[model samples]
Target chain A: MTTNILLITLVVLAIIALNTQKLRRAVVYLGVFSLISSFLYLLYGAPDVAIAEAVIGTTITTVLYLVALKKYQVFTIYFCSDPNDPNRRNLTNNSPFINNLESFLIKQEMEPQIIYSEKPLKTILTQDKFDLAICQTNQKTLIYGSVDDYQLDALEDYLLTNHGDLNIHLIRYTEGDDNEA
Target chain B: MTDNSEIITRMTGLLYPFILLFGFYIIINGHASPGGGFQGGAVLAAVFITRYLVDPNRCIQLKTLKTAEKILFVCIILYPTFFLFSTSASHTELMNLIYLIAMNFLIGLKVCSGFTIIFFRFVFYEGGIL
Candidate 1:
């Protein structure tokens, strides 16, 4: 009777782990699954295998999944250029600086989503959520980023050193500040 | 990762020595008792895992662990083969017991190091250091 219960619990945990949308929650479920299976192993008289399963399955696998999740984090950068600025026409087409930035973000293991917006910078900054926003004018490129983003520091250094010829202004947005630059 | 609560930290600190002693006891008496090398090694690994959970920023070098794992692997493989080839038909029980004990100790070391290495790698990579 107890064995049957454990088997049913194991099946349920496995299904939940597979079906869960969040990877972290799935990992936790898998941990519980492993723990139950290891107990089952002990009941079945395979203590050696049970020990290995309990150790490798519960602890090691969960940590590995979390690390993998961390390493593959995608950084979304929103590109919102002024639609009325006639001088900024063809800015999205064949822009070398934008291409370079995209490549740099890719190299850093981040997926840069460049959104070409006709909306004003104020609306994009205030209404829309984004990790970064790039506004292009005739004279300069305005890069808006969150102060809390750790990757922005490295990106700032990269932009200053590599694209020194371009007139670029970096504006940081902190919490509770809604001032339009 | 966040540090464990002060109560958990204090409790783990208080209980760590007992756990270590129990794990060693299991390893040493593996041939005669229910627990063996893998079980003991796993228990020992849990101690390290508990420590890491309390303090995520603690530095653990993986190179030494990898080296120790490799050494244990060699011992586990070679010693069993050597014993198998060299032992005669007489006094096989005594030889078997010794073999089991030696293999248990080696396996305990290997499992301990292997799990610890995986843990340290996960922590380091998660911290964006690797």
Candidate 2:
């Protein structure tokens, strides 16, 4: 009877974990599942297996999952390009820089969401908050990022080292300036 | 990641020694008790994990861990084989117990290092610290 209860609880936890939209909540549910499963293992008279299960399942796996989730956080990048620019027409679907940037973000384990905007740079900057904003003019590319973002420093360094040939300028917006503008 | 609460740091410092003692006890008395190599190693790994939680940016010496794991793994394989081949007749109970204890210790070391390596890799590389 006790085993049956534990098994049913495990099933319920698994289902709830699967159904949860939030990844963190799902991790928590999985932790609960592991805990119950460990208890079940103990009930089955395999104390050694139960100990292993309890340790690996409840602690190590949960921490690993949490770290992975943190690593693969969504990185929102907004691209605002001037429609009238002649370079815009040439850069329509095949922008090598954008592709490279996306690949770089992926390499860093970030899920990059690139939003192409027909609106002006100032309007996009002042309106919606973003991790990064790229403004493409005829001659140069302006990369606007918040000074508070720790990743921006790495991104800037990467741009300077890897894409030195490209006319890319990195602009950092301070916390005070962000609210005023 | 470097910055953590004072309470966490204090609690970890207070509990770490006891945890290590318990893990060692589990590993040493594994044959006579419910716990064994994997369980004890997992418990040992929890100590590192707790330290990581207190300070996520803690630098782990992977080279040392890898070397230790390799040595333990080699011992786990070679020791049993040596004992099996060297013994002409059936082994005594004392010999068997010694063999089991030694194997358990090696396994515990291997598992502990392996898990610690995994944790460090995940934190350093996948955690986007670089």
Candidate 3:
């Protein structure tokens, strides 16, 4: 009965770890899973394997995953603009808003990678994987940010408070939403 | 300056000697026990990791450790081939026990150094200062 329970718990933990949205939480789940598996190993009379599992699986891998997650600080930004407008070419790249945003991201300890794309905003939104997308149309700058992104709330606050004169509109959208913003 | 909590540092500090003693015990009694070199080495490596949690900026001699690991690996390979396979050496109970203990010790040291190096490299170079 105990073995069956452990096996069931192990399967449940593995599924939960796989489905967890947050990387940190997934790492924690994996740690728990390893701990339980090691216990199961001990129950099966392989104390050596159990000890190895307990040591390597529970501790080492969890720390490694956490460090990797911490080191991954790069934030990707996609800039999209109208292709036909001749003025769009010069206006998009030299914007003071982007410079400020980059500086703000750096201040937040994120390495921002800004990519200038001639593709339409909708195409970039649906096709490319981006943390934040900027669309320049006429006088207003439309910033589409992921709702799941923890930094979006702070970025919105910063933009509204500091750059009120820039006519920047922040739009929060969930992933895979096809609605035009 | 290490930003580690006083409680954590103190607790792990208290636990350090016990962890070291346990790792050594595993390596020494490897022939009679379920846990041998690799598992004990991993436990020893955990000591270094806990040391990291206590003081992130503590300097560990990685170059010396790498050299030691390589030398230990060579010794691990040579020791078995010389004693176990060579017909000239007589197999006694004491010698067999010594052989097992010595091999486990060498392997434990090698594994401990290797894991520590991997972890330190990830922390210092890949994961930045923190």
Candidate 4:
């Protein structure tokens, strides 16, 4: 009876974990589900698999979460045209930030036109629409087309939070350099 | 993190060993029924894991895991190899059982050590086997 309850609980929690959009919550619930499943495996007398599930499902996953979390502080944002102010919610942090907003907009589904630039020494930001021009560098200035300001701001904030983009050369990937503004 | 019920927490702490034994029992009786070495060993490891959870610093003893793992690996391989060479007809029931146990033990050791090593190397990174 208790075993059945465990199974049912695991199944429900697993469903919730899979469907949840929150990354941290998903990881936490997934860890619990894995640990419970390991318990069930013990009840059913499958030790080898139980061990693997326990380690991989629980410990490794928790580690993955911690490591990834250390790398980022995820923020949500979306792109839309609003010329007056592109980068909204300027997170008051002095650290350099990597702008992921433009790329988010130009994701595989967006099919953005990539433009290039001629000047190579320094880098700057310009905009076509309400989308913010996230200046990225990797030994060269990369202008990844136009991204919605909302998305760009979130990306920059994330970079700032992680303390990245200092003393690192920014590299840009887009269509061509002619559109450098 | 103690739970709501002091009795339950105390009981669980006390009963953890038995829970481990239960797993071990399943393992030892694996061949007789539907289980084998891997199952049994995992149960043993579970004891350590449980201990660790209950007291993070106290889960697996690094020295014990290393020494036992080395000895277990040697035995699993040596037993199987000896059987393969010496026994003209290892297809016999006794031989089959022995071989199964050996293989099961090896599987358990590998799984436990491998997971621990990976976790220690990539995740923990401070202590454990460097």
List model 3 lDDT by residue over A74-175, tens digit each: 788888877887887676666677888889998887778888898878888888878899887777879998776778889999988887886989898789
The best candidate by DockQ is 3
Candidate lDDT (C-alpha), each? 0.79, 0.84, 0.85, 0.52
Tell me the tens digit of each residue's lDDT in model 1 across A53-100: 886788767666765665545555667776676756578787888888
**Candidate 2, what DockQ?**
0.34
The window of 10 residues in a row where model 4 chain B has the poorest summed lDDT is: B121-130
> What digit string (tens of lDDT, one per residue) describes model 4 on residues A1-181?
9899998998899899888856677889989999999899989988667766775578656655654443333221212212333342342122123234335434412223223223321342332321223333333223233332224344444445554434322223342223111
Considering summed lDDT, which 10 consecutive residues are worst modelled in model 2 chain B? B121-130
Two-way lDDT contest, 1 vs 4, winner? 1
The residue-level lDDT of candidate 4 at A33 comes to 92
Greater TM-score among 1 and 3 belongs to: 3
DockQ of each: 0.19, 0.34, 0.49, 0.12
For model 3 the local lDDT of residue A73 reads 63
TM-score of 1: 0.61
TM-score of 3: 0.80
Name the docking class for model 2: acceptable
**Poorly placed runs, candidate 2 (over 4 Å):** A83-181, B1-3, B127-130
lDDT of 1: 0.79
**Worst ten-residue run, lDDT, model 1 chain B?**
B121-130
lDDT of 2 by residue, A1-181 (tens): 9999889998888999888867789999999898889898888898889888888899999988887777657787888877777667566586888888888887876778888889988887788867798987766779998886667777888888877877889998764123111
Q: What is the TM-score of chain A in candidate 1?
A: 0.62
